[model samples]
Target: MHRSAPRLSRILACAAVPVMLVVAGCSSDSGDKKEPDSSESSASASASKKAEPTVEPAKFAALPDPCKSIAKKTVTSLVPSAKSKSGTAATSSDTSYRAGCSWNGLDDNGVKGSQYRWLDVGFTRFDSDQSLGSGAERARQDFDKQVAKAKVAEGAKKIAEAPVSGIGEQATKITYDLSKTKEDFKYATIVARTENVVVTLTYNGAGYAGAKTPSATDILKGAEKAAKEAVAAVAGTESDKPSGSTAPSEKATDKEDSPKSSDKDSSDGKSTNRKTSANKSSVKKTS
Candidate 1:
């Protein structure tokens, strides 16, 4: 009876060992499959959270020196006898993105009023951002803001706004009159956008101590020319392009006009030929 009991106990132990092995194998296989799935899911989620790429490259890599953005000739004309020919640059933390400079002068004329002039140039550069917008588009928005800001300057009167062509990708000329120091001042503000850069130039002057105030047309032309120079500087190109005049739309108009003019000439030629035919028929009939 004791030997039979020992054999039965051994048989039970062997059956239990196979069951444990099967359970262990199942648990290990399940864990391995779950771990791989979890890893894959985590990787996919991280990828999904990644930011999208930018649509286009930034137009202007860097900004030009605000003091040097305008041509020397322009600066001389706008601000004769300027206190600082080099211009006083505005303090900014990031000059690469934004900068400004200004010049002011008082040309004294005894008994005749002195000529007082102020010229300022500012530049803003935008970089392409995945979430924001293309640099050029961002600049365009800011350009409009600059123009609006110029129009609302304190003490400004008789404000005028005009779209200027041939200076940059787009440009506006704003003129206004202001009274300061009991003298009338004339101002011309040019806000232009070229690629990713926005440029704002202000040319203002007054005749002081009995001098005659500067003319608005002169200021407008000077501001536009200086704005063109600034835009060219931002593009790192030659400042030789006509303001707004040579724009794509203008070129298209020229092309359309050329065809229209040619058609008119052709019609005139056909009319002349018909007249000649009529003359020939009359001569033939008379003969």
Candidate 2:
């Protein structure tokens, strides 16, 4: 009886060990499947929390100089000079107009000369005397005519569509009928803009019954190229405003923040002179 009892106990122990091993294997397999699923879920959540990509503002990178693209280009410097009675009227003093390369007219007899007399109004300030005359009434009339003929609104719209900065007013076309002289002529003016600067092209020729007149298309294209290049040169620098020190504001803002009388007198004298000259010269020329 004692020998039989020992053998039975040994058999029971061997059976128990096999059952325990099977249970342990099943548990390990379950843990491995659950862990893989959990890892996948965590990775998906992390990807969901990631931010979307963003874009920065469009900066004017290093573009080729617009002046370089055009031939016969000129640059001028404008400075403030005088003050006026109402307040300081800004004027151009110590201003210089650097002559550019000459434009040979397409026509054989047309004037063969490089562009000359470029005027640069350093800072744009409001002036009631923007008209081209000595007398107030005459000045007013000239100003009205200029503003009306230039079609400022239309030109500004076109400029707005252009690739350049659409910040300022620009004039594109002008026509005048001067039939008093035997060699009476019709004049036209066109302008293009880049950023805050305006480049104007003028065409003037006798409109006699059997005479030939020069077309302004070539000159206009050249001016546009030069204007673009000038803008590029200016943009390459730190500042875009012509008056490096001044900030941009609406035209109305300029009227409200008018300069002092003394300043106006000093700065506006030269502008007034130019306006007077423009009025006297019926042949519409641009600077």
Candidate 3:
């Protein structure tokens, strides 16, 4: 009986070892907090990312008006006359020499009459020498050479005959049929000198058919007026020098030679009122 008791004691001790180990594991598991659920952690990360702020692009301001610098002036003059049979007429005012021409038989009907008019302000002579401060003369010579090379004698003659008048100077005018040659149109050029600068205005148009011709008299008048205003705006009066006391800058010369903008949006590098994205953003912020 004693031997059986000893063996039974040994077996009971072995069984209690495994049970204790199990109880220890259960207690340790119960004391530890569960790690945050992977799904919850992922959701929190996603929410944090979603809460981040978004940035928007900026807008730009609109450009200023370009023509605001130009001033208003009485820049044009018009003289009307009865229709003449001859292709030419002339007038001599105190300050201007004016001439004009009309053609009736360019086309089938006699109703179309293409009239040409020109003005020459003889304030200064056309000098061949460049040292005489004859910039106008130089330009005229260059233009004449170009026209002659182009074989536009009739066109030149017409320009030569347009009516011209100016302040404190003698002006001349000439008019002619540009379609006298096989070409489809004609041009009239006016060269005048203001108090401070020289100006040349040219008008080109198609020929007349019958008595109803494209009248360029008004156009020339407008051009002359515009030129006078432009000169006065920049150079002031004949005796008054520009504010800088120097000759008109190259920019003025460029403006004179450059092609006139036909429309407001013609895009010759003029400032536009277009608002950029930054400008729009600024407007929105203000609102």
Clashes of each: 9, 30, 47
lDDT of each: 0.81, 0.37, 0.39
Local accuracy of candidate 2 as per-residue lDDT tens digits, 1-287:
98899899999999999999999999999999999999999999888867533233212222222223222213211101112112222233411111112122212223442221122112211212223322223323433453354544332222211222332233344444333445443434444333323334333344334445334443334334434444334344335534332222222122223566447776788789998888878556542
TM-score of candidate 3 against the unseen true structure: 0.30
lDDT assessment of candidate 1: 0.81
lDDT-based ranking: 1, 3, 2
Question: How much is the lDDT of residue 92 in candidate 3?
Answer: 29
Q: Cα deviation of 110 in candidate 1 (Å)?
A: 5.6
Evaluate residue 227 in candidate 3 and report its C-alpha lDDT on the 0 to 100 scale. 42
The number of clashing residue pairs in model 3 is 47
- Model 1 quality (TM-score): 0.68
Rate residue 96 of model 3 by lDDT: 16
